[model samples]
Target chain A: GAGVSQSPSNKVTEKGKDVELRCDPISGHTALYWYRQRLGQGLEFLIYFQGNSAPDKSGLPSDRFSAERTGESVSTLTIQRTQQEDSAVYLCASSLVTRDIQYFGAGTRLSVL
Target chain B: AQSVAQPEDQVNVAEGNPLTVKCTYSVSGNPYLFWYVQYPNRGLQFLLKYITGDNLVKGSYGFEAEFNKSQTSFHLKKPSALVSDSALYFCAVRDADSGTYKYIFGTGTRLKVLA
Candidate 1:
């Protein structure tokens, strides 16, 4: 695809259940980023992957949040023991290189009950 | 570390009026500034960026931003506001000389264009 792609667009899970969100970055892009947006809040940087280098995971809010990206293609964000505060629109973006123009996906809207 | 602040929570303007969304930044060395817009239920769409040279940078949808070095601010502006322009606006900044290569974003400002 010409743009970043993310799925499942909407996910609903129980408070203690775990959920995984997927992102397929633009082909040939070397940098990918994940962000979380709670309702009425700004985007909170979660994690970033640059090629094969160690991802910058400083933004991960908690130990339960983790992400992995293979090469520069597909990436997945896993949330363990989901809490109410964990519910948000999980957005994925990709850039040609780090700190370059980034294009964002439609985002996955996660709802924790 | 890099950070941005959007002072206004919301700005209301009538269609055809000029509009401005304020943004300020704190970073070391030279900074790269960017603006993005988000419609309801959608992800952010990049509008413009200021890397170097010109302080005034033009972007998509007839939007522009002025990067002020002394004030450490990059405010988005439009000559005329349209009903369709209503959306959430964000300002982001990254230190040009830093090795982290991270973009820090502001809380966001909601723009409401009235018809």
Candidate 2:
């Protein structure tokens, strides 16, 4: 795809269940990012992957939150034992390693009941 | 720690009037500032960025931002606001000289243009 692609435009899951959100970054981009936007709030950084370097997981909220990306392709964000507070739009973005601007996906809206 | 702040939760502007959305930041090193717009139920679209050199940076949709080093601010401006220009605006900042590449974003400002 020409732009970053995210799967499951909307997801509804019960509290305590697990969920996985996927993102397909633009081809040849070496940087990928994940963020969470709760209702009426700004984006909160989650994780960052740059090339073959170790992903910076400093922004992840908890141990239950984890992400994996293989060789700059598809990435998945997993949330275990979801809580109501976890309900938010999960956003994915990709950019060239040297570029400061990021192109974002439409985002996956996760609703935790 | 690096952070960004948008003082106004919402800004209302009349159609064809000049509009400004305020943003400020605190970073440990040189700052790379950017503005993004989010329409209803859509992803963020990059509007502009201030990386280096020019303080007044032009962006998409006829928008621009001025970077002030002394004040540590980057305010988005449009010469004339259109009804369709109304959307949620975000300001983000990253420490350019730092090894970490994560960007910190402001809470966001909702712009409403009345015709």
Candidate 3:
């Protein structure tokens, strides 16, 4: 892809519903990151992947939040039994390398009601 | 652990006037600092970064930031503010000691330029 792409630009579901957000990073990008941004808040780091391995999962808010990446090409974030607090914009970013600047996707706006 | 702080929630400036958005960080070792801007309904755009170089760093949109090692501060500046410059600004710091490649971000400062 030309840039980092996220699917389902907006999502609205009842509380406790499971939701999945997808990310397609730029081709050849070795590093991918996931973040959450609540209304009027800062970027919250969720996870990071170097190839298919996730070196950091410290930012996951709870056990219900999990993510996976395959061969550095695509990644998915899943939220099980979502709550209203889970409402936020899920952002994905890809970088040429770990230390390089990143390109971000428009993000998936998830609204848990 | 790496952390960033943006003390102000909002900054208002008049057109053509100088503007500054303050940021500070805390890290165990060397800090890789960065500035980013976000327009309404748009994703963040990288502005500039402080990797191992001079204290002063210049970036897009005529913006510049000064890295003060002693104070652990990276303050963004612009000599002449424009209405178009109004946006949400974020400060981030990469953890120098970790392989997680994680960046700790500040809460963001909304810059409003009055015409």
Candidate 4:
């Protein structure tokens, strides 16, 4: 793809339901990142992947949030038993390297009712 | 811990006037600074970054930022504000010596250019 791509531009789920958000990074990008942006707030880092390995998972808000990447391509963020606080925009970004400038996706707006 | 701060929640400027969005940072080592802009219903767009070399870095859409080591600041500046330039601006920083790729972002500053 020309740029980072995220699926399901918008989502509305019940408070106890599970939701999956997907991201397809630009071709050949080795570094991928996930972030959360609450309404009227800046981005909060969630996780980072170098290839298929996630070196940092310290930013995940809780045990209910988890993510995985496959072969350095598409990645999925899964939230189990979602809560009302989970309502936010989930963003994905990709970079050629860890220190390079990142290109971001439009993001998935998740609304947990 | 590395962190960034954007003090102003919002800044209003008249069109064609100079505008600035302030940012300050704290890190254990030398910093790599970045500025990004977010328009409504869209993702963030990279404006500029200050990794090294010259302190004055020019970026897309006539945006520029200056990295001041002494002041621990990287303020975004535009000589002439445009109505289209109204958006949310964010400042981010990474600690070069922290050995981690995580970037700390400040709360965004909203810029509103009045015509």
Q: Point to the candidate with the largest lDDT.
A: 2
- Per-residue lDDT over A1-112 for candidate 2, one digit per residue giving the tens place of the 0 to 100 score: 5899998999999999999999999999999999999999999999999999999999999999999999989999999999999999999999985877899999999999
What are the per-residue Cα lDDT tens digits for candidate 1 across A72-102?
A: 8999999999999998999999998644898
lDDT score at residue B7, model 2, on the 0-100 scale: 100
Whole-model lDDT for model 2 versus the true structure? 0.96
Q: Which ranges of candidate 1 are over 4 A from the true structure?
A: none
The numbered model that scores best in TM-score is: 2
Candidate 2 chain B weakest ten by summed lDDT: B96-105
Give model 2's docking category.
high
How well does each candidate superpose onto the true structure, as a TM-score?
0.97, 0.98, 0.97, 0.97
- What TM-score does structure 4 among the candidates reach? 0.97
Q: Residue A67 deviation, candidate 4, in Å? A: 0.5
Per-chain TM-score, chain A, candidate 2: 0.98
* DockQ for all candidate structures vs. native: 0.76, 0.89, 0.86, 0.81
What's the TM for model 1?
Answer: 0.97
Instruction: Report each candidate's C-alpha RMSD, comma-separated, in the order given.
Output: 1.2, 0.8, 1.1, 1.2
Per-residue CA lDDT of model 4 for A12-104, tens digit only, reads: 999999999999999998888999999999999999888655458989999999999887899999999999999999999988874578889
Regions of model 4 farther than 4 Å from truth: none
- Can you give the lDDT of residue A29 in candidate 3? 91
TM-score of 2: 0.98
Clashes of each: 0, 0, 0, 0
Local distance difference test, per candidate?
0.92, 0.96, 0.92, 0.92
